[model samples]
Target chain A: MTKESKKDGGVNPRDEAKERLENFALKVLESVNQIEPPKISIPSRSTSNIVFDEKERYYTISGKTVTRTSANMRQVKKFAQTMCAADFCKDLIESKKTATLREMYYISEGWETGGFADQGRSDRIVEDLESTFGVKREDLGLLPEEDGASIFGDIVIDEGGMEVKATKVGRAGYTIPPTMSDVEFVECGADCVLAVETMGMYHRLIQEEAWKKFDALVVALKGQPARATRRFLKRANKELDLPVYLFTDGDPFGFHIAMVVISGSAQLAYINHELAVPEAQFIGVTASDIENYDLPTDKLRESDVQRLKQLLKDPRYSDDIWQSEIKKMLNLNKKAEQQAFSKYGLEYVVDKYLPEKLT
Target chain B: MTKESKKDGGVNPRDEAKERLENFALKVLESVNQIEPPKISIPSRSTSNIVFDEKERYYTISGKTVTRTSANMRQVKKFAQTMCAADFCKDLIESKKTATLREMYYISEGWETGGFADQGRSDRIVEDLESTFGVKREDLGLLPEEDGASIFGDIVIDEGGMEVKATKVGRAGYTIPPTMSDVEFVECGADCVLAVETMGMYHRLIQEEAWKKFDALVVALKGQPARATRRFLKRANKELDLPVYLFTDGDPFGFHIAMVVISGSAQLAYINHELAVPEAQFIGVTASDIENYDLPTDKLRESDVQRLKQLLKDPRYSDDIWQSEIKKMLNLNKKAEQQAFSKYGLEYVVDKYLPEKLT
Candidate 1:
């Protein structure tokens, strides 16, 4: 057969298809920018050597040419300062907390990793709290009780209340003891004991426990409780029938620990069923307090609401009252902690925890 | 400190780290070919074109690649022929039987998804067997007497007794009626019948009601019968002296099935102690058969032996006889089956099952 006759049709299908494809390619190519010739310039100093063609609106010149000068040093410095200020403001706004003097100092030093200075400064702050405020290192309860004391001291309050204190920043403000170990719970002479936390608050509680001589004793777990601490609390509750009043920093993890005491998680295996007391209540630095006391809005981080919501979703948290309260806090998008007590000092907690009549 | 002195000791750590990384990259590029590439090839040619240079010399390709060429076409045809030959030789080699020309043709083409050409070819073969050899399909009890004429006329028997009779291509094979299911047993005309299967095999017997033929029938089930199948089998076994003959696939599953059949798996739901039969014997296709039969070297797949050994390791399968037999099979790496009858054909089976005196 002839090649043309062998074709499927009279039309040249391949050629027709190629033409259609070329048209589509042309349309796509039209979307891209067209190239242009670079602009040429001549300096006024080379005017004698240059020939200006008015008709063509073109000028020919010698080697010398004029160009815009680069940004001045003052402008550069101003730009940098503006950028730094913008970043600082952004971080402050994002965190909702003012950049501390120490943080600003670290940033100015160009230590992007914040270096050892940040950690050392934090340690110095903790040391100040210990020596200046007469906060016992043992009462700080930094290390895991099981490991004994590493950096921070173990604070065992009367009535099986325990806390870990640490100078270094890590997982918890203080290291928690392993779940397997037993915690020391001292007897502080009370039917019901209030475990006041934080250095200043603990000092006040000790003075109150001595002076008031009330039927209820006040023990201060100055730092976060180690795992053994919870077990000790459980033993105290079971043996002494002393109701546990947990107080901690007003933060997500702090709230979680209080809930852990009330509704034990799988982590606290030994005391899971035994240590958990359903009646434990969050006594201070609540959302209501944040609103009523007009605490610093900066203390409320953006993640606070989300973290509270997650804590509410936990199956272990069975108390509807606590759930509803936490939900309210999340709704308000705010959080408060008794550590704000540091701003007010020891006097504020005494007035808050122990009323004038009780004292 | 002088700026130069400070600069002398202080090198930018990040810059030094980056330099080291660049050096490492250069070294890696130098030895690019020395690094092994993944064995698998990418599926898409377009993507592979961007990532790999086909012209570059690299390690030898491990897998075969097919191309559309006349030589490839010849290889393809040869492969199909080899597979066909393997199928044809399977039974003959296994049973030491000579394949007839017709049997060879049937073996090669009969079991294909589609019906063989000349639809009545199998029927004609059966007719030749009866008319020319004086061996009737009914005499052999290959088909139920009710459907003897139709089945004998239509069924196609390959060198292996696996009969294939299809009305059309790509259709399911015709179901054999229970009466015609086991020709050898039906043709025996014996008083007592022993029907054994690897553990789970009894379900088919019970479903088929093939156990009702003899005065005292044994329905053997391999593997431990689950509660329900076991209960039903036992109820059926109890109704008549229908003793079960449990033949297993000579693997762990087989042994487990027997154990479950004989001693109910208490852990499983629905097991009944009374349903378990104590008299089941481990027979046929034992690991020992590999040695006894002198099977072709490496006939047993490695995976098969591994699985069998694992089954033998099960405490339930640790009986001295069972263990010894399994070890023998492991050493020889072979297995046997009742389906071996299919390979031996009518004469060999007749000699084996029915001697001259019995005939």
Candidate 2:
């Protein structure tokens, strides 16, 4: 890593990011003038480069790197694309403007030879730059699509020069913005943050005033949560010094969603440090909850059985609780949703189930 | 239709719905006590039962009906399931409680032989109850999943006994809740409601304060949009007397989204009267917009071509403007998103494109 990327204190992250880009440009210029081919080395985001960090309890990209040179026919266009994307980032940083990945893809049409054939190509180049500079896409002034994760209760978000209390927002709550680098979490009275998998469960908790009762922040993850949600949760857990708990359906997919928050998905291992909340715990909708609560459930489908078997082999789900739950689900051939608690009553999840799990 | 279902002038809708359901139950009870086999007749929600309403410009269920009898081995379980769902709805109405459709699916587990093997079976049975009683699922105290649509600008939403200014909410805007039956729209200052196809463009307009400048309410449709959003828009247009405009990408799918708002989809023909906003207009992102505005464009994929061809034959797109736009898109084979205007600048959309369209 460069000195600019390593410096954590005093320096502004944006300026540091700008300096890293400048350094990258300077290296490319030096290579162009030298006897060697102009080249760039980026940490590979391939599956082989991902490693499970035992200490941090998250997956991260290892030291494996891929070097691209202008001399190679396959690498020349990619090399040019990297330089073009670097130039775009420099302009975005200088102008103090941001572009969504979609906008970036469209803007690349003006890049001539450096233009991307598809959005996936442009997206991959952005990730390459992110890993190479040891900076986030947000720091480079690139935004992702708007995510649906909404945060409510026991916290104040300093967003766009306004201190907005999460509790004061309507039942839908305050949506976590795409770019959160400028956001500050302040006046947090909550002891824990519950990242819920479904909106129904989240709204139930909000309507029932579960946050007021439990001193917790409720966040609707809305299925496989977008990157913004994960980043927000990680920051909330770290900056607010609050524990994080994930509540999802009693199914394999729900378990994976929880893992994505706690351990980070292998696909995005490169930026897991910024996204993953290693300390986050998985709260129920478990196989045991199905039997214990006598919640209504469906027989596991063939696909569900296959997924359970796969989760049993996944390294991230190797914990004792995960192992036991997966085995129980496979053996029992049943799966239930977070909404299954409604069989008892509308507020059963908020009143009975959550209280038991949280405490 | 029963007289109870037709009595819409003086009686409360919930009470009317309850009465209709009770009438239905009474008829079934009478049939059970008689010598004849117990049977129930319901308006079919199938494609064959759908008819285009030329006057209203929306699809509706025709006079076609399907009768299910308990004596038939193939339909006995469905007949029982329908009866059980009606019973469930009666209980919900009595208790004044609500359950999500997913929750209703799980709750069916206690119905013994009436239990649905999958969520689709349970969901279809609920829809069957809806068409049979001539009442909405919401009226039966059943809610759909939470939608992502958010409305921002000059409007007041009297939600859950509280008056909320849309502009006063945070940047994410006011999320249209699952059940908007109890919500009221008041203090509408906007001239038109812009139902935006993508959240990015919606947020851009809000961030730029376009609502204040143009006196318009910007709503994020978030793709195909859930039922609650459609109902919300229909109410905004009908009750608040604001014109509705759909802003979407220049593609077949985007065109259908606009059409769904203005003309309604055949799949949901039964409730089109309650949800369809026939007065809505399709604003820009047209095929000609690509050339006129010099917006960046992508070539239509195989699926896009196929859909466009299908829409060419669709009765809903028989309008002169729809035909011209679809033909233009097919001839050019180019599609552009609302974000395409970002090539000019982020504010270009809010300042230039929207103002031109609105004026």
Whose DockQ is greatest here?
A: 2
Model 1 CAPRI rating = incorrect
RMSD per candidate (Å) reads 43.0, 5.5
Report the lDDT tens digits of candidate 1 across residue range A134-241: 222222321121221111112222212322222111111122222212233332334554554443344334333322443443444435554445554655466556
Q: What tens digits encode model 1's per-residue C-alpha lDDT throughout B290-323?
A: 3443322225677777777776765555568877
Best by TM-score: 2
**Off by more than 4 A, model 2:** A1-16, A22-41, A66-80, A93-96, A293-306, B1-16, B19-41, B64-83, B93-96
Model 2 C-alpha lDDT per residue in residues B66-124, reported as the tens digit of each score: 99999999998888888888888988888666777888887787776646777888989
iRMSD (1 decimal) for each model:
44.2, 2.1
**lDDT minimum window of 10 residues, candidate 2 chain B:** B1-10
Global Cα lDDT for candidate 2: 0.82
